[model samples]
Target: MFKIKHVLLLSFTIIALTIAGCKSQFEKLRLSNDTGKKMSEALKLYNKKNYAKALILFEDLSQKYRGRSEAEELNYYYAMTLFKLRDYTTARFQFKSFADTYPTSRYAEECRYMGAYCFYLESPKPSLDQENTVKAIDALQLFINFYPKSERAAEASKYIGLLRAKLEDKAFSNAKMYYELGGYDISNYKAAVVALKNAQIDFPDIKYAEEMDLLIVKSQFAYAKNSIEERQEDRYSEAIGYADEFAESHPESKLLAESKELRKDSEKGIANAKSVLAARKADYEKYKAQLDKEGKKDTTTIKTPNK
Candidate 1:
């Protein structure tokens, strides 16, 4: 048993020393000035899926070979190594740089597509800031434009559609936010109507078109309901118009009934507002007549003193 244990320990020590020696040898190769050997070893490591070590060797080889014919292949491997390690930010820059530096290289098309795809991968959710999403759309579109005949153009177009959908969702959310805040300030309701209309114009085929139209009707009604009495009649008339349009456009919508109800209420609001305005006008006229009569009597009474 003792001999068996001793033999096992010896084997383990031999394996550990072998691994350490290999690591030392790799380190020596990495620090050496031999570009040709480094490139050969980097490609070997990359093929073995050892991206971390491959990246070190490729990075070193890149500088030594720059402005030379071999630099193109070395830089391509370096960027691909970064991508394999999931360093998307740096990988994207490197890929773009590689494409720009070697537009006629066989790898240029793939590098350009990959750089744009990295932007797509970095895009955040709909609720977050969408700078990356917009960039992805633009990058992907530019790729498609440059490579209209390329097989990857279809995939690029698909990504652009997805990014545009995200933008549409953001626009819808922003408009809805204004509608929700309308209870705090009546002006926000009008703002909501305007914003929702703009969204419809901008995204004519938007999936939320019906919902946004419903919100517009609701916002217009709320705006008229909260306006001052003098403006209520005109505002309510506008609300009624919006509701009519909503009903006409979204005849099959589940919210069609709600829009019709808003229209009915707006008509009633206009009538009531007109009644109040008429009463106010009569009161003002009566007060003016009384003031005139009192002034005439004072003038007649002062005539004798003047004579």
Candidate 2:
């Protein structure tokens, strides 16, 4: 047991010393004034997938080689190292910088695409904030416009499609949330209708078109049902209109039955609202007639003063 313990300790110490020696050698190269050797070592590290070390060397060499012919190469490798290290935020900036600075370089187009791809990588899920998703879409679209005939244009377009889908999902989720909250605040039904309509206008080819259309019908119906008696007829009419549009547009939709029911219910609500309004009008007429009779009696009872 004692011999085994001694061997383990010796092995661990040797491994630690070896690691420390390698780190020391790298640090010495990094701090040295030998730009050429640093560049070579950085490239070697990058090729070996040692991006942490490569990034340090490349960062240092970038300053030293700035404005020189080798700067472009160093910058390209530096950005690539950052990308390989999964530092998308810095990698994207570096890639964009490289593309802009070396517009005529053979790697410019590649760098531009890579920069946009980094944005795509940074895009959060649909339930989260979508600023990065929008930026990614814009960047990818710019890439497509810049290189319409390039092979990567197709891939960029595909990525744009994916990002747009995510945006659609976000929009749908938001509108649906308003609809779901309508029970708490009836005004949310109106909000849901407006939101869903705007989403339809924004994304004419939205994958959620059928669902949104149904939601619009449902929201309009709910909005009308919760409105005041005087406004219910007009609102229910609007709901019926929306339902008709839904039915005509989505003849075979699975939600067709629900839309039809909403239409029927809206028609019933309008009828009920009209009946209530008519009763209220009759009561108001009776009250006005009583006031007129009293005014007439007072007038009759008044004796005109002699002029």
Candidate 3:
């Protein structure tokens, strides 16, 4: 048993030493002054999916191969290596630079598309900041502009649609927030109306168009309901107007009945507001009549001297 264990231990140690020796040899090759060997080994590592090592070696080789005929392929591979390592920012810039440097290269078209795709990958979630999303849209559109007849144009257009949808989501959410805010600070409902209107104009093809119109009508109604009595009539009239437009535009909308209810509510609100104003006006006129009667009584007594 002891001999068996000893043999096993010896075998394991030898295997470890062999691996260590191979690693040392690779290290020597990687750090050697010979750029050619590094180039060969880097491609090997890249093919093996050892992207971290491949990226380091490729970055080193890029400077050494500058202005040489090998520079074009070197830069292209270097950018791809960065992409493999998930360094999207640098990868995108490098890809763009490669396209500019070698526009006639067969890889140029693919590199441009890859640059835009990297930006698309960097686009943030819809709920987060969308600067990257907008950048991605612009990049993809530029790709299409350059390669209108290319097979990748269709794919680029698809990505643009996705990014624009994200923008639409963001705008819709912001407008909904304003509507829900509801008199929190100085006519948020009015702001909601404006925002929804702008969003509709900006994204006419949005899926939320019907929903946005319904919300606009709802917001106008709420704004009128919360206004002072004198302004409520005019504001509710505006709400009614919005509801009518919505009904006309979205005849088949699921919210059509609910939107018609908004019109009904606004009409009731206008009538109630008018009633209150009329009551207040009648009270004011009665008080004025009392004042005039008292004034005339005093004037007549003074002129007759109580005789």
Candidate 4:
């Protein structure tokens, strides 16, 4: 038992001594007037991923090396340290600043890409606020435009597509919401039709294209059926047009059954409307013939003053 206690005590002593040695060495280098030594140590710490210590040293060196040749490298490391620490907002700002301040530096292009990439990292999911997503897209596009021959252009383009899809998702949701809205007083069905149409135009290759077009057909059917008799014929015809479009576009869609049903209903509605219009026309003609047989002169005349 005494031997084990001695060993444990010795281990604890060694650990305590190691900690004190590190702390003392760090303090010694921190207070020294030797910027060269500090720069070397900071770089070593940064490369080792000791961002906390690297950050402290880099901050100190940033002010010391201002307007000097070493400032470029120092600022680059400082911005990267911020990025590695997950301080993306500040890191992005610093990266952009680095690029602007050192436009001709070898690291400028990389820092510009990093600035945009930071925004991409900050982007939320499709369902959340997309301000960051927009910024990411804009920044990335600017990067691509600024450096068309860059090796990073392909990756930036891929990210731009991803962010655009997210925007498309938001648009789809808004349009779908209009479809789901209740009450005819709001004309939400019209809004739904307009929204879906715009989505189709904006994203022709949208993954939801089939579903959205099917929805448009359904909305047209509802809008037609609920309309007054005067509008039912024309509206039902429009619904038929939409149904035909969906059928031609997606012949194998599972929603084909629903589209077929909408077609049947709209055709029936059109026939009924036509029949009613024919009956009204016949009744008007019959009344006019009776008036003619009665020799009715229903014209009115205004006589001018005799001259």
Candidate 5:
């Protein structure tokens, strides 16, 4: 029984040692005062392109110096590490937080630019949802507003312009699709009008606005031209509308002469068809009366005519 008691005490002692060793390991991490040393080490790792290890170290430093002067440096390093590691969302968040918390810090402007860049990196093609594109544009605009003299300002402005153009292209393409699919009765007017408006807004000084306006006039003319004769007066009336619009919008267009000729043809066709139909109906009535009179005379005078 004494031997068994000794074994039990030895086992308990070993377990206690193991637990203390684990506790000490955690305490070392918790109580370490080597923040600057750790930061330097992480920077070295980052400069060496050891992104994973650098990320871990920077994250630890960010936590260690949350509100200290080192905090901004720590956050910047952390965000850079995540960026190098291709962890963009976390990098974006880290940069945003750093900028927001230290807006007046020396590193603040860099953080703002990089934060917007992170969003720019996340932007997808226009075929995809434009949530990131919009965010990127807004961030870039804010960066310019705050740092108009920044060396990066021109580049940021250029990117914002490209992104806006991409979005406008998507909008224009969608509108054009409606016109192509004959969705007019379903409100194609809206699409054509919006397309022209967007082109005007986006490329007001370019040839695109002029071209889109011409297309709108053509589409409106075609829609009205398809109506029946009884419904055709409205068609000609609408054609005149497009003629007027085209004349006013593009008076010097090479297409002006053709547009005038088409209008004249439509007017002449309507008048000629109506006149021909009336003339044929009148001739048919007169021929029927003559036949009736000849038949009655023949029935009355048939026997005397034989002699």
Candidate 6:
């Protein structure tokens, strides 16, 4: 009786295991089928340009198929949906996440490219903060490296060029504004000089490099003109320093001849002021001495004049 009971228990256990295995398989098939249907619907909406609805369907599919092949596809399409909707900030996040999650996937390179485009999309005018420009440059360069053969490689390269020039223009515009605002004061002049130097560093080949050189020279000349008469010598010295730097940096610049003429005038003015100041001091001292001698002689003359 004990042996018979044991066999019956064994038979019941086998039956239960078989049923459980079939149920698990059925669940897997059902999820797969549902995922395919959802993906199909999302694609239809995407094709119709109904991004609002498409995004919802894609996002739902991504969540439902987490840890499955369908999840990766869903994530990629969802990012594209966000891009189409002009929701670049969220799209950028999604693309970055997908790239990280599927670095070896076939879509990795395209994901990176779109990520860079999203950064480009977020960038404001060249005059605004350049945080997005920097990010775009980094992403584009990475795309260039990873997908040299990609169809979008040329476009990525173009964006990099554009972004770099934009940053350069922003710096140049700021420095030019300082110069325009009568920035001949010591602090203002220094600020303009620093900004122009940074522009050169950031964009050596920009067409306005020569223009910036001229502005630097003009700033120095103006600064020299505004100094106190007594301090004009020091001011001229500093002005000549910037003038020389500009001349050396841009020997063939269009403003070269004019800059030289200004330097010469500054030097001559310094000399003439010093000479006049010295002569005035000498004349004053002589007059003071003569007055003192005359007073002493008159005091000794006593009443002679009245007699």
Model 5 Cα lDDT, one tens digit per residue, 190-270: 356557666667666543554565566555555445443444455556656666777787788887776676667657656
- For candidate 1, the TM-score is 0.87
Clashes of 6: 0
- Point out where model 6 deviates above 4 Å: 1-35, 183-186, 244-252, 279-307
Candidate with the greatest lDDT versus the true structure: 2
Please give the range of 10 consecutive residues that has the lowest summed lDDT in model 5.
298-307
Off by over 4 Å in 4: 183-186, 224-235, 248-254, 269-307
Candidate 5, superposed: residue stretches over 4 Å from native: 1-37, 183-186, 198-207, 226-240, 247-307
Output the TM-score of candidate 2.
0.91
lDDT of 1 by residue, 83-201 (tens): 99999999999999999999999999999999999999999988889999999999899899889999999999999999999989998999999999998988999999999999889
> What TM-scores do the predictions have?
0.87, 0.91, 0.91, 0.79, 0.66, 0.75
The C-alpha local distance difference test score for the whole of candidate 2 amounts to: 0.92
Report the lDDT tens digits of candidate 3 across residue range 1-307: 9999999999999999999998898788767789988998889999999988888788788878988998988899999988988889999999999999999999999999999999999999888999999999999999999999999999999999999999999999999999888958538999999999999899989989999999999998998888878888888999999999998998898999999999999999999999998998798678778878888432222122110
The positional error of residue 194 in candidate 1, measured at the CA in angstroms, is 1.9
Tell me which residue pairs clash in candidate 2.
none
**Whole-model lDDT, candidate 3?**
0.90
Q: Local error of candidate 2 at 279, Å?
A: 1.8
Considering TM-score, where higher is better, how would the candidates rank from best to worst?
3, 2, 1, 4, 6, 5
Each candidate's root-mean-square deviation in Å?
A: 7.1, 6.7, 7.2, 8.1, 13.8, 16.8
Q: What is the alpha-carbon lDDT of model 6 when measured against the actual structure?
A: 0.80
Error of 3 at 280 (Å): 1.8
Please identify which of the two predictions, 3 or 6, would achieve the higher TM-score against the true structure: 3
